[model samples]
Target: MALITRLSTQSESFNSALRTLLAFDASQDESIERATADILKNVQQHGDSAVLDYTQRFDRVSAPSVAALEIERREWLAALDQLPSGQRQALETAAERVRVYHDHQRAQTWTYTEADGTVLGQKVTPLDRVGLYVPGGKAAYPSSVLMNAVPAKVAGVPEVIMVTPTPDGVRNPMVLAAAAIGGVDRVWGIGGAQAVGALAYGTQTLSPVDKIVGPGNAYVAAAKRRVFGTVGIDMIAGPSEILIICDGATPADWIAMDLFSQAEHDEMAQAILLCPSASYLDEVEAAIARLLPTMPRADIIRASLAGRGALILVQDLDEACEIANNIAPEHLEISTENPQQWADKIRHAGAIFLGRYSSESLGDYCAGPNHVLPTSRTARFSSPLGVYDFQKRSSLIHVSQAGAQTLGRVAATLAYGEGLQAHAASAEYRLNLSN
Candidate 1:
């Protein structure tokens, strides 16, 4: 039996089949929603007490107060110090590369004087504080800590508060080390919807954050959705996805493992391969089968492949690029002789990896690009999380006396035409003063 569905563009039912494959039921689970609502409401009203209750109940870690859950700066430094030399070096290297990449994304305030001496520009400013929720316990993601916190720091955020669940009260040292390296100001041993609520609505111990960024379980996602108006959020991400456009030139095993990289994330992740050669697709399938037994997460990879993965056959690379534009996958790998030529044709993808050597895993860990990409075709209109997400722009306008006289007349005319008498009067008053 085949591990993944194989589709041919020549089939009459191809469109319908493709739609079915792409469709993901993103609808919130009713039970989860109700629970999340209750948690958020409780946390908002009761503050630290509510967070403490939920933390104890969910994480099974009793704390005297929310303050007790806070990890000190010394602890973070100690964690970094305790790490094996190799692991510490790797973390530092990844952090430095990420910092360098985000440094290039920083936006500076700019202003230009017009002919009439009117100054107009935009002032770029970072948010005061940001909340980073990292998955903890068995699912420790130190890379996520660097990805989220480092960008916020690069944007010049004054403080970054990190929250992670410590199931059975065992903290992951790597996560703490990452917090230290990424310049996270505070760390709290809290998780789920309660942590999100605490970040959104200030608790007695934990002050509210300007924005919340990071990944977590369903409850955390739900909490972020509910509190969007009160505080900004990075994105309500869907399952991970990877789309590889191969020209049958890359090695089959390399392509197979690349697909597995995303599939191992969870059962809902989608991995699709598009190539002109049918025989190459078969070879990749053979490789997947041969390699499946070796992976520790074989069951998860198998389920993910069986559920949402595909081996697509296109007429040529052009058709494949067209289909890729429509899909707008989170991670797009163009593996061919001249990969950049095909990449130039692509307009909608979270991140484009060129050539056979560029693997998605490298981007996930340390390729100097953000791994927090738009998923489930959201890449068509959205972008990957970056330093931009942590910063905002304010329009600057300083009109000179000469400029006001000239601009106010236009403003008054438009305001009057729109039946806004007060607006017209205000502009006309400015014109009169300028005169």
Candidate 2:
């Protein structure tokens, strides 16, 4: 009777059907690619003039110069003052926690000398500047400002420039307030692929950044993909996804709400549940049907659930964990008596929410871990955004007289084998100089 699909491991055609369900076409739309290419070229060639024109056309913010789009520090503070006391305190608290957590992840430089006087070490340096993209207007998310900027600042990046689309010249005060709280260096009222192009290519007033982070709609995603090599980008993320494995001991309401948390992101977002107990699966399904009418975004939840969401009955919790590894969801919740037991089995997931109390929403806001996670099965190879993403490492090798003689022979041999006479001679010359 439930709108969502119900699958069983006992079913004959489960494997093929599940594969069909999991397949998502990540290829960019050709039309979007063409449009993004044109925008990037315009910004690269015309610089600020192109930015101003696009701002006028898309966001309807027609400032005489791109410089006027900058929301200065005092303006950020004024926006902070506009917030109610409760909202201000909450933003500050969330920012402080995020800062504290990332402080532990900061990397430092180190070196050591050997008996031969050879120095070997690594030097870590923070990026000079980073650009953050936030969905502006009705989609304004204050949490994004804190999540993206705080980590870069914690990593010692000198400047953090944020670009958010302000359709019709309207700005969200809470977003600006979060920028102030997170210590963001600059805020610009801009959005869409044009905003992405400005960040990637740089205009007259806005300097290009070392990297771009944050999320946006389709056009923004396409732009990020195109400008990847010119400027670093975080990742081309897909829809929100959450996979929950429960032992059926936990309350059905807890699991149902956790599933809904991700479903409300959008219609394409995925929320799946895999459990060993069939009765518990039924209970959760009933709970979902009962609770659907209560949610303000019930319409969205309904479409997402009917379209992509699923409830599966697995052979056992072990089998559930196996399937979870294959899916590699962005957010994985293990709600059971022994969450750690299953947690130990998980090979891939962007972030794991263990126990009923550890909801995904907490990670999205105040929880210590970064909420910008790898989505769309990228967890197999990538990881969550953190201070490390804003930092770079350079290897240091200082070969001494004794060390060079030893290192030269090895280097010369490899160089000669590679058919580069100049490289071999360079090492040979160094060897003779030291001898």
Candidate 3:
């Protein structure tokens, strides 16, 4: 149970608390380089053989061969049809919502020409191919399929390939159903570093992908980091996290339940609350005590809350905002009367849920926003996974004679300053041609 407070504190103290709360060490146990390198080598050398070996070793099931790796479109569609109408409707609604939101994020190819005839703009192109890795360890998250694939589909990616671990050598029908809704081109019953390797290096069955995106365990994060240059990745995700800022009007049970949601994700997951009132903190603590026993995974939540989670009492709303900004939490909920007013003070956060009604779970499940967010305070730099993850941008430049003449001298001078004779000569030649 967390005890909240509204106590005044120094800016430095608030910042320190924020750092303590949000600080996540990227460097951890497990040599992903060595692990990924060894796995990549095996996959590169043996291709499907290595993938099978790892699948058996990690997932405890033999992987489908290259010939049988891809699930047919008919199989996928049938799986969708087999789902209960209510579940099918939910999947369709979620997919359509995701598609609609991401559709707005689609980048367009644009070219702007100045009066001087200097054409400068950005050309956005979808990757020829992409691979999404979904974790099948827990319950199958069809939402993940929608989150990762719909963005790519919206981005116009030609082929969106998917991989999920299958421990029983059986694909979850819901997983297949989600794939169908998201327009995934292929679903492979393979997972872990081997799947990442297959996506990066291309096996006898799976085609190499330009980029891979989705959430996975620490090993998956490590594999993605290891294969970074070989293939693009979204981000080295950290454990799930949630932070709440409350003035205490909301029920403590609501706050406690919300905290429990993130805490149950993993032992390392974090749940924190910043409250500006002592009475509220006390109420939340009581509510947490009452509610935690009801959850099936209460042990996981209790461990996470006791370990990484905390209740901070701030003196004022301004201090609360400072702490929130410093923490740069993955999920931030401002449960205050003037949530919008306080939300403006938050400078760093992956996603901000304004008001008491905007619960974090909504964003995790049905809210159109993708739940794949920056964690471990990486919100300070990165963003949630979205359509932009599946697209590449190329700079477009076309300089007319006049534009070249006007720009080439400066270009040549800068190139010469850097002691690059070839670069200077190229620019000088263009300038001379204009003359």
Candidate 4:
């Protein structure tokens, strides 16, 4: 009945065992990669016809033309109008909070004049268009529609095109409602690698987007990888991750369910708990055994917990903080009395949930901050998606006549040192007083 792993930092084998527990093989399947490559090529060469054909083959939804796949702006609004009162209110509230949070992230253009009258700064502008890919099949995540599209719209992206797969050609009203509330310019009921390809390569019916954002299955991830250079893409998200550092003060069932929140994501998802109290770890284990049977996705949660989840006894709260930084988890919960102290000590995490009341589930839903965060320890280098993702910056330089004389000589010196005679001559020509 040992459903999950138990470890101790004091054990002689702890380091090796920790490595084994933390290891995740994120390599894409060769078959998926090849399939994605073929799809991308076909979409590139054949345009709308290729997309229509693939939609029939992959998603099993047959449309006469790719244009028929598009869900018009009025339909998006109708979807919004059809929503139940509570669901509609929730979507509107979440959208407003997300928009308000991103408004602070907008970068402004600035230029400063030098003593020689040289002007230097940078200009920031929003992307013209963006593509959002929402997963549709078993579930409809209206939250995802808000999370992806709201930030892009807040960044002032003019057009947002959305793609979601509908098996049996059944559309989810909430997703469309979210797209409407999020201000998406267009919506296309299509998904898988073909949807990604259509967005990346631009078919006759769907215009190519500057960047593609949102989540999908393995095939979609591979297609995004193949088409990265042609267009920008959000992070290739891995399985869900949650690491909680508990001080043993919170109720055990609360912590147990928190672990289960991420574990239900799938087998590859990881959920780990670090605590200084052995008794608390025991209490959590008991809670997991008692509560897990009641979960609807009990099999998935059990598989995820047994495969990658762990509960480790650390030396102290300080030691738990150190290990948390090393893990660089996607979702970190500092469940303690003085959570801020431990939070301040932490250096890497996609998002940090502080105190006993702050749950990772809240961040996934109505949180003002972004929920689309870096995964698989990518938080160490990459950041969560934000308004900055949809904005590009260009450096501005206006050199005065006197400023050019000074800058031209410096440029000539560097060009001469690098042995570029043409570059040196070009700089020298600017320095010359031509008649």
Native-vs-model 3 lDDT? 0.85
Give residue 263's error in model 1 in angstroms: 0.5
Q: Which digits, one per residue and each the tens of the lDDT, describe model 1 over residues 1-435?
A: 569999999999999999999999999999999999999999989999999998889899999988999988899999999999999999999999999999999999999999999999999999998999999999999999999999999999999999999989999999999999999999999999999999999988889999999999998999999999899999999999999999998999999999999999999999999999999999999999999999999999999999999999999999999999999999999999899999999999999999999999999998888999999899989999999999999999999988889898899999999999899888777775623
TM-scores of the models, in the given order? Answer: 0.99, 0.97, 0.93, 0.98
Against the true structure, whose TM-score is highest? 1
Q: What are the per-residue Cα lDDT tens digits for candidate 4 across 1-435?
A: 469999999999999998999899987788988888999899999999998888898778899999898888887789889888998999999999999998999899999999999999999999998999999878678899999999899899999999999877888888989998998888898998899999998988888999999988889899888889889998999989999999999999999999999999899899999999999999999999999999999999999999899999999999999999899999999999989999999999999999999999999988788999998889999998999999999999998888888999999999999999899898778775562
RMSD of 2: 1.4
Question: Over all chains combined, what TM-score does candidate 1 have?
Answer: 0.99
lDDT, candidate 2, 208-230, per-residue tens: 99999998999999999989998
TM-score of 4: 0.98
Ranking of candidates on TM-score, top first: 1, 4, 2, 3
Model 3 agreement with the true structure over 1-435: per-residue lDDT tens digits: 432222235455655665565566668675755776788789888898999889888878853576565668898899999999999999899888888888889889999889998999999999999999988855688999999999999999989989998886767889899999998998887888889989999988777999989887767777888789989998888889999999989888889998998999987899988887878787887888888888999888888887788877788888889878878899999998979999889889999999999999999867898888998888999988999888899999999988888788999899999999999899888775624
Cα RMSD for predicted model 4:
1.4
lDDT of 3 at 355: 94
Better of 3 and 4 by TM-score: 4
Span of ten consecutive residues with least summed lDDT in model 1: 426-435
- Estimate candidate 3's RMSD in Å: 2.5
Q: TM-score for model 2?
A: 0.97
Residue 109 C-alpha lDDT in model 3? 90
